[model samples]
Target: MDTDRLPGCYRHPDRDTGITCTRCERPICPECMISASVGFQCPECVRAGSGTGHHPTANAPRTIAGGVVAADPHLVTKILIGINVLMFFVALSDPVLARELALYGLYRDYFGGTLHGVSTGEYYRLLTSAFLHTEWWHIAGNMLALWVIGGPLEAALGRVRYLAVFLLSGLGGSALVYLLTEPNVATLGASGAVFGLLGATVVLAKRLRYEMRPVITMVVLMLVLTFVPLGGSLSVSWQAHVGGLITGALVGLGMLMPAAGRNRALVQWGTCGVAFLLAAMVIALRTAELT
Candidate 1:
């Protein structure tokens, strides 16, 4: 056999060729080839797969429920943080804009009083209020907590569930504020939801057998600070914090429930449904009273 006439392996300089890895074009030995329905692929080539070309095995990308494609697990947290940062800039754009957008009940009397019961098409404010903050420090503190607590919680519970916790907690906070305070009052900030995350930490800590002391202490401190009335601003909504904490605690408990303990999915969903219904009821009642 003339060595010069032998086909060289595509990936290896010294090796003479067998058949190519139809997909990657790398040379494959007989022993390396794995048999499939259509053809054979080398172990290395199969492991280092390609999108197009001769595929030994046809495998489609897998999808989960809700048509969600798998992606980097951290993507949700990153996107949330980015949105918060963007909203912060938007809130800081003009003094008037900030007052109007930032959640404040009666503290900013003009903005709050004028907008209250006026149907200014600001219904989305309940949701947006979670993203807006009074100052850089407020945003920074919440973001830091989100990064620290959210990263681990999301990793443990998964993105969908983590998002549920955040959104529901925010809604719970808003609902509490709506129920307890005057409509003329406005409240803003992620603190309520962040506090809910703290509540989650407490539950998770218990589940994982981690010390609950730190979480409890932190929660206590947060509650204390919330009531301290920073800079004589009675604008802060303690009711929101309380509601968020309750919601987060319940959600965390649901997450911590054992898989073997009877249809955890149904239980979680039911809990969420109840919370949503309660929030809706509060909103309806308040709107009715206002009207």
Candidate 2:
């Protein structure tokens, strides 16, 4: 038998493995392989053969998207909030650093120095901008929204999927802003990521058969407010909010709408990848236009 030609894991088709379940002969990855009396068995075989007689699902802890249940469901959310807060403080202390990290296509600072943007290949700003804020109220509102919306989402999608959705949403927002807004305008904040969690919340609520009116109402209100211009220097990027909201909703559908016993993980991550690819293409097009 050609080891290279061996089939991938039954549970994770992306992972190639030579090992097979001793009883069922099904290929399984390291994570799914359980040691039996004579040889390794897949999770299904072990669950079926368990003397305790509990159901297969009852024996294994899994999240809504089929990830392992973590001891701290909100660990990733806390870390994200902490990073944002820390970056906020750093931006406050060193104003120059904030200018460097903000999302912009291209601009010249007050000092008349030419500051590059995604157009000039300073692409890190696309993600880093999501972690930075200069105004106290800006960070406060975003962090509050994140904690309220992100906690439950992290619990539902698990850390990996939740993180992927978040980052792609942020990138989507930045990409849209670059494509639509003026090159000189600077945008910053985690509003994109927070809006993503909001979108995911709606999807989860619908999937669990929870009432949808309140969620829909909240989404509508926020979206409406995005278009309302604030007088003076204060302004909202409706582009970012819309972009993040749509990206999050699509990702949530991918993660939650799959049937059980299907390749749920693959579908979930593939959706995330598609979201990223769309964002990247937008960025590339905008970069070409700006440069």
State TM-scores per candidate: 0.67, 0.78
| lDDT of each residue in 203-268, candidate 1, tens digit only | 866754444677789889988888875653435678888988998888777765534233756776
lDDT of 2 by residue, 129-246 (tens): 9898888777888899899889878876778888988998898888888899998888998988788778887887787555478799999998997888754444788888988998
lDDT of 2 at 173: 85
Which portions of model 1 miss their true places by more than 4 Å? 1-73, 95-100, 104-122, 232-235, 260-262
- Cα-based lDDT at residue 128, candidate 2: 95
Query: In terms of lDDT, which candidate is strongest?
Result: 2
Collision count for each candidate, in order: 7, 0
User: What C-alpha lDDT values do all the predictions have?
Assistant: 0.65, 0.81
After superposition, which runs of candidate 2 have C-alpha atoms over 4 Å from their true positions? 1-58, 109-115, 229-234
> Between which residue pairs do clashes occur in model 2?
none
